[model samples]
Target: MCTLTLAWQVFEDAPVAVAANRDEALDRPAGPPDVYRASPLVIAPHDVEAGGTWIGVNEHGVFAGITNRWTERDLAGERSRGLLVADVLETTSAADAAAHVERTTSEHEYEGFNLVVADAEDAIHLGWDGSLSRTAFDPGVHVVVNVGFDETFALPAERRDLGERQAESARAVREALEPRDDERVEGWLERAGTVLGDHEYGVCIHGDGYGTRSSSLLAVGERTRYEFADGPPCRTAYEPVGIEGQF
Candidate 1:
């Protein structure tokens, strides 16, 4: 995943809402959403090469997703970061998932990554780049990209700003998350797609063989509803995915 925006306990009724754009080379092999009856009972899309996932939700109501962190060093022979998302999905709580990532960073040499793990009650943001740190989400919206969490919205320091492209993308997503009176989850999902399709900020990045491959929208409350678009949101419509057996 590249650009991720999460709304946590920000809406009156919905406790969690997530919009993510997975940016990668167009040739990478991946599948749409499905139920995996593995140890943690996952519901996620699959990455064929690494046998892992970019985003997923487990039976325990734990939602896990990962964003690559920009770095020049390549730690060869390390585990795939996609596998980290899969492993964290097996945990019961957001805290446990964060801890699971912390443990892995301590024992292995992997590339940089920013992970977001959440449940109905809380969300945990973990960043690993030779070191690991955990941050709990406040009752509001937050955005994370390859540079880590964007603190410019919460803090006034210029140093907290994200990269130019990422900052622009975050602004677009934030505008899309403005309050809407409609109570239907579908409305929010549609707005999420709009944010993903916004090209002004590169939310739907594409050029020179790399681009946004898939988009996902998730709403978790009394029930979890997920919508997935197989291709870029600019050209694809999100289809309702059955997540009954997943949780």
Candidate 2:
């Protein structure tokens, strides 16, 4: 996933709410969100090229998403970062998942990435820009893009030329999201999808060889709901992802 908004422990009923858009090559083959594992109940859209997922949630109420950091260097990892996302879903909690990342990245090399792992009780953000650094959220709304997680989009001057499009996109989305953070209310996830689909913000790109491919909205808690769109949210309709007894 290239762009995402996470509301961790921000709701009375839903402790973990998420909205994300997966940006990728137009020709890249991918399957819609589905149960990939039964043991721990993993549900996510699968990247056919890598057999991994860019985002997902598990029975444990653990949510994971990744955004590739902007860089001129080639992605050198032997393993796809999406696979790491899959491995994390197997973990029981956010802390365990954070440790998994710490240990795994120490032994393996991967492209620059920004990752978020959260549960009802705990949440963490891992920024991997050559080297990995970890952080904890203070319980509220947050935005993450190719530049990594931030309370607000602070476009780096050095990267503006190379990543301004995505950076500006995040800025626009953040502008739309500021109210939710200030008022401390609900429904931000669905509203996030609406803004993501808006062309003005550049969140939904068209006529571009590479752009948003799919979108997802999820609520995790005593009652969990998941919705997904096979194509860009701009023109495609979203369908509910059934997780009947999984969670």
Candidate 3:
């Protein structure tokens, strides 16, 4: 499970902004953001183990991300959910991506997950547990955790505390961005970095076996930008990644 927040058409100058903190076992092997050699040309981090990705943006100006759903099940050798975001990036618009998630009958082979696909004008959240649910995001701020949007999905009692923390973090982020003076992407990135590192909860979660690995901030406007932090936001700075080359 991870933490992700989205601001859709929240700013006049910048139509879309997303902030995410990816939590996983520190031992998982992955690479930083790079141009994904696919039909639509995506920029995302490479999940070496699964040969997929967690977050990415395509040349069509569509940005996508996936988060694991908290459920009691073991799909040990099943298909990787990390690739879902990249798969959605293959489409040209958020509507097409949502359609892919809605009609894809093959998703049952994978574990529970939430996939968010967004373009300049549209944003969609597709949730798949045993069944599927879709939410067309309105022009406002939205937060999603592993339990699904607004914590509508079931979560074990032991993990409920962490889930609450995630919800609070989302509210904190929204408050921080709602009435800001600066409109530049750089300013948003800097503010996002601070909020992503909030230690009250797992926004920058730390534990014996699992913790935050990296943080990503994507801004879509006149020109799209993706900034990645190689390590935890508490100790790392975000760097702008180039999506032109394979590296």
Instruction: Estimate, for each residue in 159-247, the C-alpha lDDT of model 1 and write its tens digit.
Output: 34445557666766776676576445557667777878877657887767888999999887677888999999898888988876455
Candidate 3 ranges beyond 4 A from true positions: 72-77, 105-107, 150-154, 179-182, 244-247
Least accurate 10 contiguous residues by lDDT in model 3: 177-186
Minimal lDDT window, size 10, model 2: 178-187
Comparing candidate 1 with candidate 2, which one achieves the higher TM-score?
A: 2
- Pairs of residues clashing in candidate 3: none
Candidate 3 clash figure, as a count? 0
Residue 78 accuracy (lDDT) in model 3: 66
Q: Quick one: best TM-score, which candidate?
A: 2
Q: How many pairs in model 2 have backbone atoms within 3 A of each other, for residues 3 or more apart or on separate chains, i.e. clashes?
A: 0
C-alpha RMSD of each candidate structure in angstroms: 3.5, 2.6, 2.7
How does candidate 3 fare on TM-score?
0.89
Candidate number that wins on lDDT, 1 or 3: 1
Candidate 2 residue runs with Cα over 4 Å from true position: 72-75, 151-159, 179-186
